[model samples]
Target: MTQPFLSIRKLRKAFGAFTAVHDVTLDIPRGEFLTFLGPSGSGKSTTLYAIAGFQDPSSGNVLLEGKSLLAVPSHKRNIGMVFQRYTLFPHLSVAENVAFPLRVRRRPEAEVKRKVADMLGLVRLESFAERLPGALSGGQQQRVALARALAYDPPILLMDEPLSALDKKLREEIQAEIRRIHRETGVTILYVTHDQEEALHLSDRIALFRDGRIEQTGTGEDLYLRPATDFVAGFIGNSNFLAAEHLETKDGASTIRLADGSLISGINANGAFSSGQKTRLMIRPEAFRLERGPTSAELAVEIVDVAFYGERRRIVARTAAGQEIDIRPTSAAMASQEATPRHRRVFFDPGAAFLFPA
Candidate 1:
């Protein structure tokens, strides 16, 4: 197997008495897009800074290509960084901004010009090379920032919420541009973001952080579908969590009783959950279906609210137990069930439900 390009071994950081990052470790493969996802103050940014050598770790080692970077200076690390703000020099033209790093490296003027032109073309902003930073749009300025980061031909790039300053449409546009540049250049990236959708869309793998610790790390689908912990299940996406009591296991399948006295049979227990153990059944909003099958568990609910989301309809239902459940149905499925009144019976398949020990 090939070794990872970046290896973080038991990395830790603390501010005075408060530990910002606690024994975090991860391996980022070469040319892979890895994202650190979490809420504010979750240590995601701190970890990124530590890896970039901007913030010293309280303990542990950061290795790049099997070499420890403990004594390396920030500027000498040769890692490229793009922050939330464009950080472009307002006084310099786009071409000069992209050439800043090459100049710092004392490259010959001829070579710097060639590299700056290539970088601008890579970002599809070759035409804007002569324009000053103030003359370009926010998105264009960010492209310049990206071009500048790549000017020196760094092996790894670190982005800290780089797209958060743009509007929604512009953010998406830049996201695609970033992906394109990553593929074309084959540069490994360590991206940091709090947006779940962005992380899911951009990362090859995601490290979900919480309270200065890594809660879980997996592919987007793994974290979304087979979450290892309840925190991950709730944090990754929308879920309907129903309380249940574990029952007997038969033939590797475990049975659980719901709050409404409904029996739900699902895969085996995740941990050492035994009979009578408290559990929570997790089901996505779109997992439930409205059907008339007799074998399916029925719910007595009232449609309290409805929202049309182009491709699907979002329905908020209040169960007889007074718990609110969110359900999403395709436009066709919703049309087929239009005959049902506001207060109606809804049924869902047990196979779609995932039970997790609470």
Candidate 2:
């Protein structure tokens, strides 16, 4: 196999007695959009800062192609960075701000002008080129910052929660723009964000951080569907974890008994489980079926509440053991039913759910 384009080898960071990032290591392939996703102070941003040269790691190496980046200064590392705040020059016009990097590098005036115009067009900010930073909206300013970061065409780009400050609608809009730019430029991107949806939408792979360590790293679907741990299952999406007791496992399948004493077989047990071990079953809200199938685990539930969403209706139900779980059924599924059944039975495929140690 070829070498990784960017290799974070056992990266760690500490401040005084506190450890911010703990042995976090990952390999990023070329032209790959990898996201560092986690909550605040979860070491996501700290790990990104180490790669961007904004913060130094206490120990470990960040290798680009095969060279260590530890001794390189932030400016000389040839990495572009976009921050959460629009770090644009207040005095410079949008066009000039985008051209700042090339100017500092002392490129030819004609080449600088050409690259600046191209980057402005790439970010869809050519119309706002003449405006000052104060005159532009928050989203527009950030676009200019993006254009500036890519003006010199660095081999790698680092974005540190660049859209965190924007409103949801605007954040989504810029996210689309970023995805388009990544496709066009093919610059390897390492983006950091606390937003799970943003990470799912933008990244080719995600490294989920929790409390200074990496919980899991995989594609969005892998992390969501085949989660390595309960933290991954809970972090990637909305999940309803029902308590269960492990029965046995043969081959790759396992049997478990739910709290209500219903036996569920053929479930995906992602870990080793001894007989009668306590376990937790992970069932996504959309995994529950209102109708029974050939291979379905039936559950007796009391409908507590139902809310209508355009695409899907949300229903909250409680099992006989008083376990609250959420289920989402499409509007078409309920179109035939006259009224909400006070006592309802639901079914779910064991293959779609997971079992983890409690």
Candidate 3:
């Protein structure tokens, strides 16, 4: 097996008495896009800063291809970093900004020229090369930053919420550009962001950070469909957790009775559950079926509100116990069913629901 190109082992950080990161470890293979996703002040950025040499880790090691990067200065670490704010020199033109790294290294002038042109072209900013940073748009400025970061052809690239400052449309445009660059260059990338949609859309794998620690690390689907903890389920995607009472377990699945006294069996569970234990059932909004199907569990809910989305319809419902549940059924299904469900039975496969202790 090919060894990881970058390995983070037992990384930690602290400020005064407050610990910002705790024993965070991750292995990133060459050319893979890994994202550190979490809420604000959740230690994702702290971990990235450690890898970029912006801060010395309080403990543990950061290795690149078996070599430790500790004690190396940020500039000498040979890592590329694009920050939350575009740190471009306002006076420099796009091409010059892209060439800054090569110029710093004192490469031959001709080689530097060629690299600058290549970097601009890689970011699709060839036409904007002569424009100064002050004249460019937010997206364009960030593209220049990306070009500058990659001008050195570093083995790995680090992005710290590079698109956070842009508007929604511009953020998506740059996200597409970033994905294209990753595919074309195949440089390993470690990105940090609080945007769950961005992580799901861009990363090959994501390390979800909570307070001072990693909650889970896996593909978007892994974290979404089979979360290891309630935090993972709640963080990765939209999940509805309804209070339930555990009934029994058989084989790998367990049974639970919901707050409305509806019984659901064959539900997936993270750990063992005992009879009469208070628990919660996690069901994704998209998992509900408008019409009952095979091996389905039913819930009695009163439709509180409905809204149409492009692909699915958003339904706000209240259970018999007054617990709110969000359900998303495809538009076609909603159109075919009753126009307005005053109070109805919604069905979902028990296999798709997860049980966690309350």
The numbered model that scores best in TM-score is 2
lDDT of 1 by residue, 172-193 (tens): 9999999999989999999999
lDDT of 2 by residue, 1-358 (tens): 8899999999999999999998988999999999999989999989988998989999999999989999999989999999999999999999999999999899999999899999999999888889999999999989999999999989999999999899999999999999999999999999999889999999999999999999999999999889999999998888999999999998879999988888989999888999999999999999998889999988999999988898888999999889999999887887776487999899999998999999
| TM-score for each predicted model, relative to the true structure | 0.94, 0.98, 0.97
Q: List the residue pairs that clash in candidate 1.
A: none
Which rank order by TM-score, best down to worst?
A: 2, 3, 1
Model 3 misses residue 189 by how many Å? 0.3
lDDT of 3 at 151: 96
Q: How many backbone clashes are present in model 1? A: 0
Least accurate stretch of 10 residues (summed lDDT) in model 3?
A: 332-341
Report every candidate's CA lDDT.
0.87, 0.92, 0.92
Candidate 3 per-residue lDDT, tens place, 60-123, comes to 9999998999978898999999999989988888888898899889999999989998998888
Off by over 4 Å in 3: none
By summed lDDT, the worst window of 10 consecutive residues in model 2 runs over 331-340
* Alpha carbon lDDT at 106, candidate 2: 97
Question: Residue 73 deviation, candidate 3, in Å?
Answer: 0.9
